[model samples]
Target chain A: MAQELTTQAARDMAAANGDANRRAMAFTPAVDIFENDKATVILADMPGVAADDVDVTLERQVLTLRGKVTPDAPQGYRQLSAEYQVGDYIRVFTLSDDIDQAKIKAAFKNGVLRLELPRSPKAQPRKISVKSA
Target chain B: MLQTVFSPRNNGDLFADMRRMQSAMNQLFEGTRTAGQSATFPPVNFWASQDSIVMTTELPGLTEQDIELTVKDTMLQLRGTYPEPENGDDITWHRHERVDGTFLRTVELPFRVNPDHIDARFENGVLTVDMQRPEGDKPKRIAIKSA
Candidate 1:
C-alpha cells in the first residue's frame, strides 16, 4: 500500500512539474476496462512505436510493455534544439487469473495500442434468478 | 536523362508501370515473405487536412537522413533506406516486423502541394510534414455585397 501511494505521489509530482522530464508520458492511459461476455480491452496511447519496436510479455500474471525508439535524427546531426530523446519505453501491469490470456489480441492503429483480453467462461458475469416456491 | 536509361515513351503503359513497381519491390524487399509471396507494404495510417497531408510510415531503425520526401504537382513520394545493419549480427528466431529497405511510397494528394512550403520535423521516431497546399486550392473569403 505504501509503495502504491509513493508511485502515485511521484506521478502527481511529475504532473506538477510539467517540464521536469521533458519526456512526456501520459500520467495514466485512459483504460476503459470493460466486461462483456468474454473480454477486457486495454487501449494504450503509445505513439511513435512500431510493431517491431514493441515487446509485450506476460509472465506470472504480469503484462509488460517494452519499446525502443528508433533514432529518427539524421546522422552526424549537430542539432540546435532537442526536446524529445529517443530512448526505451517500458510499462507493466498485473493481471488477475480471471483474464483469459490465451484469447488476448492486440492491434495498433494511429499510435493507439489496443489490447483485447478475453475472460474465461467461468469468470464471466451471469444473471442469476431467485425462484419462489 | 539518358535516353537508354529512361523507359521508352511507348512503354509507359499500365503494364510497364506494374513491372517497374514489381521489380523495385523485389529489389527492395526480397526473401522476407514466403518463398513466393505477394508484394505489399507494411501497415501504416495516414491522413490529410485542407492545408496539409500527413503520411506516417512505420519505420524503426531508420534515421531522417535515410528518409526523403519529395512532392510533385500532385504526388507525394517517400523513400527510406534502413540504417546500416548491426555489425556482423547473429540472429535466431526473431519477430522482424521492422521492414527496412529502399522503400518508395508514392501517394497522389487530393490536391496539389507547394514543394517550396514543405516543412518536416521528426520527434520520437515519427516524422510530421507540414506541406502547404497549392495556393490556388486554398480557401479564401469572398467580399459580400449588399443585395
Candidate 2:
C-alpha cells in the first residue's frame, strides 16, 4: 500500500495536565479579544485548519474552540529543517452572564476564527459590533 | 548621618529606565526556554528533494494580496503585512496577543534555485513555496575515461 498523501503529526502539549487519553497534542492558539458596550469579539489564529475540521462548542459558562490540522508533507520529500511544530489547536474561555448565549456567532476564514458574543438585551443599551460579525 | 538617596546622575524618566532594565532581564532568560523561541515573526519549515526544495510558513488572517515573494539565487524572501483590527480606538481590549505589523524573512535554500521556476501558493493561511534548481546545477554522472 502506498503511504498516505497527507498525515497529521502529533506533538506533546506543553505543560499539559495529565490527559493521557488525548491522542494528539493541543496548542493554545494566539487570540485577540475585544469588547464594546453591545458585544465581545474574539479572533483566534489556527493555521492549516480547514472549515470542516474545526469545532466550537459552548457548555455551561465555558466556550471551547478546537481545530484539527492536516499537514501535507509532500510525497518522497525529506524534511531538512523544521522551525515550527504542526499540531491541533484548542482554547477555552469563560463567558460571563452578560453575554447572550443563544446569539453567539462564529465564522472561520483564512485560518482565523472570529467569534462574536452579543450582550444580553437587559444588560445595557449601548451598541457595538465587530465589523461583519 | 547618611547622604541623600536621590543621586545627581539620574536624569531621564525613571519608569523608562526601569522598563529597559526589565526587558534586559527578560532577554537574559529567553534563550534557555527552547530553540524555537526567537524574535522571528512567522516560523518556517523546509523540505528538500533531489532537484527541488519546498518551504512553508503559517500566516493566519492574511490573503495573497498582503504577501510578497521573491527569490535571488539561494535566498528566498517573504514579506507580509497584517491588517489591523477594524476599529482601532473605540473598543476595549480584553486580551491582545495577535500582532499587527509588517514582517520580512529571508531563508537560504540548500541549492541555488532557478528563479524562473519558483512556484508559490497561499491557502488556508499558509504559504508554500516550491523551488527548482537550474538544470546545469543538478548532479550529473561523468563518464570515466581510462588513460
Candidate 3:
C-alpha cells in the first residue's frame, strides 16, 4: 500500500546575528518514515555525521534528533568552490498516543539514523473469532 | 435550517476544498524535488592551492567497496551506489524522501592534475579527494633580478 508522507518541518540555517564566530549553516536532514504491523520506523540521512556525534532524545511526547558534522577539510587548503552546503542537523517530531514510547530503539550507521517506535498492544489489530451456538 | 441554507459550503465540500488546496500547495513545492535531481549527486566542495586541488562529497549509506573514483587530465569522476535496506514483506512505508541508487558526478578542474599523486579517503560517509597539480600547470614564481 502507498503511504502518505508529510514534511512536518524544514531545514533552517542557524541565525548569525552579526557574530563573526557563528557557523554559516545548519540543515535539517532528509527523513523517511515507515510503518509495519509491529512498529513505525524513521530513517534520517545525515552524511558526515559520525555515530558518536548524534543525539536522540524523547521528552514529554516530543522526539528530537541532533547531529553535529565536524569539518573534515584537508589541512592547509583554502576553499575555492563549494557546490554543497554543510552544517549540523536538527529536527523534532511529536509522538502520538499509539506509539510505545518506552520501547523506542535507535541505530546509526553509514550516516543514516534508523529509529523504531513500537506500537502499543492496544493499538495493534486483532482477529476476532465469532462463536456459533 | 437557516444556518445550513446560508452556509458557504457543507462539511464534505469543505474537506474536498482542503484536499484541493493541499494538492495545490504540493504542486508549488514540486520544484524542490526537480532541483535536487540535477546533474549532481553527493554534492561536492572544492578547494585549490598553488600546487594542489582538493574536493569532498557526502556519500551516506555507502562504503569503500561501493565506490569507484577515476581521474584523467583535469576531470574527476566518482561513481557509487547507496543500497536500500532490506525489509520484510509486511512492511509499509509512511515516507521515503532520500535518493537511493547509482550516481555519478564528474567535475572539471581549472588545471590538469597528476594522476599518480592523487589521494582519496572515505570516512564517516564523506569522501575527500586530493590531487596535485601537474608540473606544467603549477604557477611559477620567477625571482626578480637586481638591475
Candidate 4:
C-alpha cells in the first residue's frame, strides 16, 4: 500500500554527556528494523552523507552508526528561508546475543544505510525428528 | 552527547516510542500545516542571490530518473516516487518508520525565472536547482544628475 509522505523537522541531538566541544550538529536518522527467521535488517535515512564517510562498528554488544555530512550552503547566496538543517547523523543500537556479530554486513546507497545482522546458528530453531522402531 | 536507545530484545520497539513523542510534538505545533504551506514530504530550503534563486531538498534512496522537475514562469513543480523495498511474506517488520510513496508539490517563486536558465543536480541524495533571473526582468538602476 502506498502512503503519503509527511514532513518532520529534524531533531537536534541533546548534550547529555555535556561535551564541551562539538564541531557540527548531529541529528538522529529515522530508521526501520525488521526480522525474519534468518536475519534482522535495519535501514536508516541520512541524506548528504557520502558512502566513504559512513562508519559502522560493533563493539561488544553495542552497534554504532555514524555518518558525516559537509555543510551544503551555496556560496554567494543569502538564506531566504530554511525548513531543515543539514548535519551529521548518529545512532546506536544494542544487539542481542542471537545476532552473529562476525557475519553482520552493511551497505550504503543513495544516502540510506542498510545493515544485515544474521542470526547465530546456535540460536536458530531446529525441528527435532522422531524415530519409531 | 551520547544517544543510544535502540533495544531490539529488551525494549520492544523504540520507534513506537519515538512515534508517540513525534505525535505529541505534532500536536504542539499544530498550526504549521496551514494552507499554501509547502511543508510536505521532502522538506526544502531556499536561497537567493542578486539575480538567481537556489532551491534544495533531501530525498534519500532516489536517483535522477525518479524525480521530475518543471519550471513555468514563477511556478516550479517537483514530482517523484519512492519505491517500496522488495520483501517476502516471511519477513516481519519490527519498526517501519521509513516512508515510501509518491509526492508532488508546486512552489511559487518570488519572481519569474527562465526555464532555459535553470540548472539542477542530484548529489548525495540532495537535489539542488539553480535558476537565473530573466534578462528582461532584472532591475535597472537609474543614474542621478546634480545641477
Highest-scoring model, DockQ: 2
Candidate 3 runs further than 4 Å off: A1-21, A122-133, B1-36, B85-88, B135-137
Estimate, for each residue in B1-147, the C-alpha lDDT of model 1 and write its tens digit: 565433667455868767777898887777676552235442334455656665455444456677788889988777777654322222221112223466777766667888898878654446666666888889888999999
Per TM-score, what order, best first?
Answer: 4, 2, 3, 1
Over the true interface, candidate 2 deviates by an RMSD, in Å, of: 0.9
Looking at candidate 3, what is the lDDT of residue A112?
Answer: 85
Highest lDDT among the candidates is held by which one? 4
Candidate 4 TM-score over all chains jointly: 0.76
A1-133: candidate 3 lDDT, tens digit per residue: 1122224343334442344675756676777887788888888888889899999988777787878888777788899988788878777787777787889899988788989889887765557999999
Q: Candidate 2: give the clashing pairs.
A: none
Error of model 3, residue A73, in angstroms: 3.3
Candidate 1, A78-131: lDDT as tens digits: 333333333445556777778777878987654445677776666756679989
Q: How many residue pairs clash in each candidate?
A: 0, 0, 1, 0
For model 2, residues A1-133, the per-residue Cα lDDT tens digits are 0011212243225333346665556777778888876788889999899988989988877787888888757788999999887878877777877788899999999889998999888765557777975
Clashing pairs in 4: none
List residue ranges in candidate 2 displaced over 4 A. A1-24, A124-133, B1-37, B143-147
DockQ of each: 0.04, 0.60, 0.53, 0.55
Residue-level lDDT of model 4, residues A1-133, one tens digit each, is 0111322353446322234465567777778888877888988888999999999988877787888897789999999888887878877778887888899999999889999999888885667999998
Query: Which 10 successive residues of model 4 chain A have the least lDDT summed?
Result: A1-10
- Give per-residue CA lDDT, model 3, range B1-147, as digits (tens): 455432565564767667777888888877777654544676789988889988998887788999999999988888988787657888876667777888887889878999999999887778888899878777889999999
> Each candidate: fraction of true contacts kept?
0.03, 0.84, 0.85, 0.85
Q: Candidate 3, residue B145: CA error in Å?
A: 1.8
TM-score of chain A of each: 0.62, 0.75, 0.76, 0.77
By TM-score, the better pick of 2 and 4 is 4
lDDT of 4 by residue, B32-78 (tens): 78543345766889999989999999998899999999999999999
lDDT of 2 by residue, B81-140 (tens): 999776756588877667678999888888999998989988888888999989999999
